[model samples]
Target: MRVENLHCSKRINPLVNFLIVALILSPSLTIILIPISFLLIMVYNVIRFKLLEPSVTRDTHEKFLQFIGGEPYYMDLDTYGKKGGTYADAVAIDAHNLYVLHEDNAVEIPWSMVRSWTIQAPGADRVVGVGMTAAMTAASHNIEAAAKAHEASGLFVFVADVNHPKWQFRTADTTILRKWNEILTQRNEGLLAA
Candidate 1:
């Protein structure tokens, strides 16, 4: 006599089943998942870092740095030619305000007080800035974006001094961003790996 079939289909985990369903329903789920995963990893890493290296990032002041966002950053009156000068202990954001804390102050800047930033000397002395006027001036002077003038249209600087123009800043395309997402993805992986 012939034997009857007895094998059953393999079981799948409910957790995985839900994920499949959701992914199928919304392809964008993958996009959302990546950042969320990275954020979670970052949070975990930060917590781990705090535990492992307390001195490296003690409080927000020691760990936090000021960097600008966006592309084609402007050079302004407050931040122009602030480089090649002394470093500043107190970084002035505008005419009335200054940021000197290795930590953030409780008082929030109202945006009106902002003026510009500065750069400092190599030994971390002196001060300078990249003001709006400076950016406009740079642009107007060359008939090109400041980024192109210094071959830095992709980046912006924030000076450590009002007189000097070495302001703190970030670039639209840092060395890592040149290759686009591939570079960034690799960078993110590297950061996580570190």
Candidate 2:
């Protein structure tokens, strides 16, 4: 079963049409209007995704559950895509495997093939200065630290699969990271027992 979470065509068509009409009707204004229109679109998307469309995540989760035929041991519904877009991507763990669900495809990796996993806070390694005074350096360091603290965290998994060795999923909510750590600990303990 294939699940498509992105409706890019539906969203893009109207925007494209609007741009075309603007160019035809007022070519002189097109240059000015284009940037304004794009800025408005960006703001609208931020509002829609961050506030209005949380249901999209739930809906994607439901569809994935249907595809997998049961509840997963662990699942994160809110995850960013590979290129930092939100296409309702998800990461899940069943009894025997880990699953990465993208908009068009799904990858299943056996539990035995998961070499390791870590929760990585984004922007943690960002460098603040090339050459600056101590005061400036300290201030930059503080700002960078603050930014890192607020940035989305990601789950990075190292797998043995040749084709797809690494999988990463980013989420703004830190609770998801904690839950994933717990699940991984339990799974690891089970594996050691067996």
**lDDT for each residue of candidate 2 in 1-194, tens digit (9 for 90 to 100):** 12333332112245655665565466576555755554464464455446424555666667677766688766776633222234565788887877766453556677888899988665544445443344445545665564455344667788886766777665656788788877888889885222
lDDT of 1 by residue, 1-194 (tens): 01111111122245644554455466566654644544453464345434433332232222122321111111111112112111111121322222222112212122233343222222112223366545434433443333243233222233333443332322233332233224223333543222
Largest lDDT belongs to which candidate? Answer: 2
Go through the candidates in order and give each one's C-alpha lDDT.
0.29, 0.61
- Top TM-score hit: 2
Error of 2 at 192 (Å): 11
Question: After superposing candidate 2, which stretches have Cα over 4 Å from the reference?
Answer: 1-14, 17-39, 47-55, 79-86, 123-153, 191-194
TM-score, predicted candidate 1 vs. hidden true structure = 0.17
- C-alpha lDDT of candidate 2 relative to the true structure: 0.61
Q: What is the TM-score of each predicted model, taking all chains together?
A: 0.17, 0.60
